[model samples]
Target: MGEKGECSGVKPSDDEIWAKLVPSDSRYSDVEIRSDEKVICSEISAAFGDKHSWCKIIRNSDLCSATVENKSPNTILVDGTEVHNENTVVIKDGSEIIPGPDKGGFVSYRFDILSSPETSQRQLQICVDVENAKCSICLNIWHDVVTVAPCLHNFCNGCFSEWLRRSQEKRSSVLCPQCRGVVQFVGKNHFLRTIAEDMLKADSSLRRSDEEVALLDTYSSVRSNLVIGSGKKNCRKRAHTPVDDQSDGTYLQCPQCVHEVGGFHCNNNTVHLQCQACGGMMPSRLGFNIPQYCSGCDRSFCGAYWHALGVTGSGPYPICSQDTLKPISEHSISRIPLLAHENNVHEQNITDSCIRQMGKTLQDVVSEWIVKLNNKEIDVTRLALNHVETINARTSVCCDCYQKLVSFLLYWFRISIPKYRLPPEASAREDCWYGYACRTQHHSEEHARKRNHVCRPTRGSNM
Candidate 1:
């Protein structure tokens, strides 16, 4: 009665009455109708729409994980950012498939998102959304969602364009849709423009866009001109300082915001350094920088110091909370790591457990470099500086090749250096190796240049 997938919202005794048929004109470009009798679709939306329709009519085809593209250039872009690249694939959903934008974006790994390998949580997709660089706005939420840019704010497309066109007639510029910064440019990364055009063409179901993004560059410059005569206001409310606050004399913070407070004003880096006036430390790390602009006042806060926002411990500062609240950042982000030194070595690269695999299949990574050095194909200086990484891994040397390698190491020592620096009263192989001095001496740059440290098997580690 109500097109193919439904029977007039009445109880259909058999699924044949309804359920098996899909309407010809679908609203979403992201979906496909594989069957004429019934659209292959997810049961969730289908049942919710037609309550009386029998549940059995919902098609139960397991969409195979396959990559698809436009048969010709007839390939319409479904969603600009969704399947943005030529390599993007559509995981089949029963007979229904996400329709177009059948091209764009490269893929790192094939994941069974809908029903296959559930290795990743469903939330992982949102992480991909945040990282999309094409759109510069902050809240890039699409499907009637928007990202705010220039002002770097997001508003619905309709909301933004209406706001922009109307606001242009009267004032120098309007405040941002979200932040209220005097607006300037939305730049080229206009996501709403893309979304509106694609949705209209595709006959989509996503809601309407609201507003455009803009930034006020001139305000800061004019304020810079006015800084000499501007009056300052002071609020007497004192923020609660924890008993366990660090002894660094940082007591001043924003009572309202709790970020760092500085000389009669607030600064962004107050997270790292204590406020000169109020002694409050602000937030610095955690993927966020300074917050000089306050949402309360259109003007930036100039203070004795900045506001403090973080909870502190005697050891390391507490993990910042701003990112923890977001669904995507919490689950998808990797922690900031320490600065890796040039000589830093990981334990996984070595260890007999890795080297002695089920049968120790030959891997020539380490051996190839050693052979190159022995042949003098490259410079010795680079070889010495780089050898640390290659040394730990097991060589691909066969028994015969291993013997030749051992001979080469010995031959290298004999030819390159005048002597192996044996003890005053001991042999090069005995006293030098047993001494603690050998470990220190051989590992140094100068010693490495004189003798190559090639991996040489000695009858299966008997040495």
Candidate 2:
């Protein structure tokens, strides 16, 4: 059943396609971020760094990230600078799927912030679909479902079905929606319904799973956060000791064990809890920049001084601040070059001699036997040097003048003929049997015999 005189066009959604293409159990990889981020990605230090200074992570934080692809899309340079890296995208849609007419496009999230980073939070957000961003079958929008006619145009199903009904009364096949010519596909609503159903089922399942999983993950994370909160509270309660027990202001004791352990010690204005035995340190409940350590003798001191650490700098290491240690030795580098640069004119002189031999026949080869230079027993360089012009002229020279002019020129230059270079396609069909070709090889032999020339290599010889 074909639509008569009807135009055909339909487009399907990405969900419809992925319904069949993607596995059900597959979990898409996503960038996991937290509300309380502790990392700060510093700018590249190109001025101070020697070469390739971009490192993956910086500071004491392992979680914070700074990369090109992660940048917001509108922040993208109009100069078409490609920020290459997966998960480091500027596209806004949040999904990594991109679909197009022919096939796939991954959708990425991007904020319109690159242009005004300071005000980026105030601007509207945009998502760019990038991966597998195609679908000739569907119109390719995840939001809308459009029918794809065999003609490959995407259109609304309602409009297309009516178009099909109207077209069938006049012709054998449906015309393209835009072209109005007989094209394949019987325009029907069933196909559109089927595609829509596929999309709905897939999207529905994904949405449900996302909602359920998100809540569960949030619950787990919240529980862990609660645990940390509880630990911090318990540590605070255990951090105190009695001032009445210590006779001198120089000492403090743990309230729990009544031991002369690191506890909050009061100075004139500042308060710091330090374990007297082991040098464990913690900040007092009051303020910042206070240093304290456990007075415990054997066990490693617990780090409670982080509360007082200034955010402007790295936390003080143990030896310097109670729990951190400095490296024993530092790394060093030396810059001695392996190769020295020189003019090398002495060796270059041997090379320069070949250029002088150019355009000159073998004066030495014609007179005396030559010795080996690099390894070839043939004086090819002298042969090439002498015959260079003739070989170059062979292509442009007239066929009739080839023998007389070429032969006379070679004889004057006393150059040796190395090989018979026949014309293109002519050599495949036939050889010059009776003409100048036969005389040329004969002249070469005669020349060779007259010189009693045994081939030998010489300086600057190539081939």
Candidate 3:
């Protein structure tokens, strides 16, 4: 939070300071951090452009607090404590930080954690729509989802493969079952296959028997992407052209496949990631510094594409902002997101009160635990999150990922403290049966606040 602990930088704007600070909130657990920001300072100053005198927010990582760094030799009071030059006082939520001796300068701002509206609304479980998943040929749920290009029709892999084989025997061009466009390309849609499996699980009646599945698997031919029969035996063989030439092939191709863009051309084997934000296509760069995929939603984005291409969003073709994607370590946040602690706003409130009573702020508490986490002083076995094994302070994660990490670490901090040391309200609470998995934690804020979710099962409690 400091130049390894010094404080001598220009004061920043409120928005700028908020961007660097990361207060804990559970909602950010699944959301991306604001991508458009660029600044990464850890402190805030009350007096900007002042050479001789001012107040500053000092990040004391060793002490686990954001201290008020009094640069002015005069007496500076932080929450009524007289602070001298270069010395610091711990900052708390709503603690008044006054610059100049005895508040004479009139520069004052209160340290506070900003909270956002809760986002726990989820759709109720409902019946699966098997009809949408059914293939036109088989009239059953798709065995393996395959999307045909040009017409963009989707069908079972087995159904398409069989139709393809029959069409080839007659030397006739293949046609889309639904749109009748000459099929120019086809690919196994992995994302859709996952959705199809979920549908079968939701309604077992939609599932085909194992024997049927095995037969379908044998007949399926679509692997990654297949360039289907070109021109028309479906319509006359045209002149030889690049795969992207619509005149050479009846079906259309993705934007990247058809033209030279950013000094690159897509050949037969280029794996592509379609941007979820702008359906543009960019070659997938696995293990590359260019961030093509968002760590939060596991979706591809084109922000890095524009950046790498040395182009702007104002380019003729659609170009996403570079802020859309970046390494997680590159993001600098200063406030705890409001949705931390599994969206249980109440638990965060209790933890905030407990920290204040102990003469510390939320930032101070999180800093202490983060140091423990980095030193391997805390156990990570029971952390509730995906990819738990790979999570660490140094891991590059989206904003949501960072919040989830903070929430998990905070849980450990609360539980590790002795019962007597906990705030009076939290000290007397009983642990819930569901722990972090309780459904009520999502819907009822009161219930989540009343019950302690950090405790282990008692000898006679419900399992």
Q: TM-score: which candidate is best? A: 3
Candidates in order, TM-scores: namely: 0.20, 0.15, 0.43
| lDDT of each residue in 275-393, candidate 3, tens digit only | 56665556554456665654444556777666776756563345566656665445544555576666777777776766778887666777777678777787877654444555555
Stretches off by above 4 angstroms in model 1 are 1-175, 178-234, 237-265, 268-312, 315-463
Q: Which candidate is the best by lDDT?
A: 3
Q: Whole-model lDDT for model 2 versus the true structure?
A: 0.26
Candidate 2: where is the Cα deviation over 4 Å?
Answer: 1-150, 186-463
Better of 2 and 3 by lDDT: 3
Per-candidate clash tally: 66, 79, 21
Listed per candidate, the RMSD to the true structure in angstroms reads 25.5, 39.3, 19.9
lDDT of 1 at 277: 23
Candidate 3 stretches with Cα past 4 Å from truth are: 1-263, 267-271, 278-280, 295-297, 354-386, 441-445, 456-463
